[model samples]
Target: MSANKAVGIATVVMVLCAWAYIALSREPRLPTSIANGRYSNGCCGTIFLHDGVMTVANQRVDYIIERDKAGPYVLPTAYVGASVHAVVVKFDAYPLKLRLDDAAHPHQLELLDDAADGVRYSFTRVNGS
Candidate 1:
C-alpha cells in the first residue's frame, strides 16, 4: 500500500482506540440494586430511597447532582470513602456522603455524614426495605 494510505489507516485506528478507552473508562452511575431501599439508623430514624427520592426522618430529599459538583454516585466500588466503598452523593438536604458496611452486605449503607462535623449516622437495611 502507499505510504500515505498506510499512515491514514494508522491514524484512524489510533483515534478509534482512544475514543473507546475514554468511553469505557468514564465513571459509572451508582448501581440501583445497591442504592434502592430503606436503611435504618439511630433509634428511630430511617433513610429511604424510592424511585430516586430519598427520605430522611420523614423529610423528602432530592438528588442534587448538578449544583457544580455532580454526584449521587452510588458506585458499587468506593468513590470517596477510600478504604471502605462509599458514594459521594449530593442531596437536596443532609447526608451528602455514604459508605458501605462491607462486601458481605451489598444492599446497605454502612455510614453517613450529615455535613455537620461530628454528626454521623450509621445504618443497616431494614428487612424488605
Candidate 2:
C-alpha cells in the first residue's frame, strides 16, 4: 500500500478502537428508584423523578436529565466521600447538585446549592409516592 493509504488505514483503526473503548466503559447509569417518585421540601416546592426525567421547582419545569454518574464526584465536603448516584441541575435561581444518601435502601437525597460553601437540604419522599 502507498504511504498515504497506510496512514489512512491506521487512523481509521485507531479511531474505531477509541470509540469502542468509550462505548464499552461509559459511566454507570443512575438508578431511577433513588430519585424516582414525588418528593417535596414541604416549603418551597415539589420534585418529580419519574420515567427517567427530573422536573423540580416551586414553579414547574420539565428538565431532561442526562450524564447521570456515580460519585465521590458531586458529594459535598461534609459527606463521607462514599460513592452514590449524583446529578446536577441548572435552575433559574442557581445550579444544584442532587446526591443520593443511601444506595442500599435509596430513600432520601441531598439537594445542595452550587456555591462551594452552600446550604444542603435533606429532601424526603412524600407519602404514597
Candidate 3:
C-alpha cells in the first residue's frame, strides 16, 4: 500500500472513533413538563430528578407559594416548613434577588422527572387588602 493511502485510512478511522464516543456519551435533554395552568420561574433554569426527587438549579431559599390549578402543586406554603433539601444556586449578596413565580407568570422551564412527587398542594396569596 502507498504511504499517502495508509495515512488517509488512519485519519478516517480516528475521526469515526471520536464521533462515536461523543454520540454515545452525550446526555439526553430534558423537556418542559409544567402543567398547562401551573407556572414556575425555575422553568428557565435546569432541573434534575433522581429517585423520585426533583431539584432545580439556581433556586432561591425564599420561594413564594401561589395557586394555579394546572400545576402539579409541589409546595403549598411560602415558608417551606418541610425538612427538604434546599440550596442557593445563585445570588449577588446583600439585598438578595430571589427567583419567585406563580401560575400567573411562567418561564421556559424543563421537567427532569415526571414520576417524582416533589410538590404537594397549591396555595395562592389572598386577593385584595
Candidate 4:
C-alpha cells in the first residue's frame, strides 16, 4: 500500500480506538436496583443519594454498587464509612424497591452501613418521593 494510504489507515484506526474508549469507559450509572432520593432518619440526619455519590450532611462520597449485588465495595475516594456492603432488599408495598426502609415513617431511617465519621447511612437514591 502507498505510504500515505497506510498513514491514513493508521489515523482512522487511532480515531476508532479513541471513540471506543470514550464510549465504553464512560462511568456506569447508579444501578437501577437502587432508588435515588433524599433520606433522613430525622435524628440521624439527612443524606442524599444520587449519581453514585452519597452526600451526607453535605460531604460527598463517591461509590459504586453493582446491580442487585451486595457490597464490600470500594468508593472512588476515601469516605468516612468506607467499609460497608450493601444489597437491595425488598420492602413492603413501597414504590421504591431499593429503598432503605418503609417510607411511611418519614422520621425513621435505617443505617445500612457505617461511614468514617461513625454515622450510619443509607444512600442510593436519585431524588425524594
Candidate 5:
C-alpha cells in the first residue's frame, strides 16, 4: 500500500479502537429520581453491585457542601432495610435488598458527589402512598 493509504488506514483503526473502548467501558447513566418525587437534595443516587440488579434512588438527603462554598449535591447509596420500601427503581423492578446497615454511620456525601454522574435526591423512594 502507498504511504498515504497506510497512514489513512492507521488513523481509521485508531479512531475505531477509541470508539469501541468508550462504548464498552462507559457506565450506564440513569436518573437519580422520578419526576415530581419528594426528594431532599444529596440523598439519592445510583447503586452499583457485584451481582443482583442495578438500581437508582432519590431518597436519603446527604448532600456534600463544597469547601469553596459553591453548593451542595446529593450522592447515591445502596437501599437497605426499611429505606428500600421508599425507593422506586426504574422499569418497575423491585429493588431487592442486598444487605442491612450494621452501624449508624452518616452517609458519605463527598463520595456520592464525586461518583454520581447526574443530579441527586433525598431518598430512593417517593413519599406518601
Candidate 6:
C-alpha cells in the first residue's frame, strides 16, 4: 500500500479502538442532585452551576458559592461556603434532596428550608424550547 493509504487505514483503526474502549468501559450514570445548567425559581433572577461552582442571583443581590467538592451528594445534607451580598456565610449542612417527579422528566431539586443563605426554594431546569 502507498504511504498515504497506510496512514489513513491506521487512523481509522485507532479511532475504532478508542471508540470501543469508551463504549465498553462506560460506567452507569448516576443521577446527580447538583445539575450543571441554568435554573430558575420563577421568582429569583437565576441560578447557575458550572464545573462545581455556583452563582445565585436575584433582582437585588448576587451571591457567590465557592468551589466546594468536599461533601457527598448522597445524604440530604450538604455544607459549603457561600458569600451572600459580600458577607461570607457558612451553609451549615442543610438538606439538599432530589425529587424525581417522573422518569420522562429531569429530576426536581428540593432544597427545603434555607438550604443556603436564606434561599429556601425548589428549582427546575430552564427549558430552552
RMSD vs true structure, all candidates: 8.2, 8.5, 13.7, 11.9, 13.6, 12.1
The predicted structure with the larger TM-score, 2 or 6, is 2
Model 2 local distance difference test score: 0.51
| TM agreement with the true structure for every prediction | 0.49, 0.48, 0.26, 0.36, 0.30, 0.36
lDDT ranking of the models: 2, 1, 4, 6, 3, 5
Pairs of colliding residues, candidate 2: none
In model 6, the worst 10-residue window by lDDT is 59-68
Residue 30, candidate 4: how far off, in angstroms?
6.4
User: 51, model 6: CA deviation in Å?
Assistant: 2.7
Candidate 4 residue-pair clash tally: 13
Instruction: Compose the digit string of candidate 3's lDDT tens values, residues 13-99.
Output: 999999999888733222223222222322232333222233444333333222333442333112221112332233333221112
User: Candidate 4's error at 21, in angstroms?
Assistant: 24
lDDT of each: 0.50, 0.51, 0.33, 0.45, 0.32, 0.43
CA lDDT for candidate 3:
0.33
As a whole number from 0 to 100, the lDDT of residue 30 in candidate 3 is 22
1-129 in candidate 4: lDDT tens per residue? 999999999999999999999888734444522534566443345555566776665566555533223322323334333124432222231222222343222222345333336434554322344
lDDT tens per residue, model 6, 1-129:
899999999999999999999888733333443455665555433555544455553212222221213322322223322222221223554423333233334433333333234554455677751
The residue pairs that clash in candidate 1, if any, are: 30-74
lDDT of 5 by residue, 1-129 (tens): 899999999999999999999888733322332121232223333443212223335333221111112222222233222232233433333222221111122132222122236222233323441
Identify the superior model by lDDT, candidate 3 or candidate 4.
4
Residue pairs whose backbone atoms clash in candidate 3: 43-108, 43-109, 74-119, 74-120
How many residue pairs in model 6 have overlapping backbones? 0
lDDT of 1 by residue, 84-120 (tens): 2222333332343455544323455644442335344
Q: Which residue segments of model 1 deviate by more than 4 Å?
A: 1-5, 16-26, 30-34, 64-97, 100-105, 115-121
lDDT of 5 at 125: 24
Candidate achieving higher lDDT, 4 or 5 = 4
Candidate 2's residue-wise lDDT over 1-129, tens digit each? 899999999999999999999988855544454455776664445566664455543233433222344551122212211112332343434333466655544466567644466566566777777
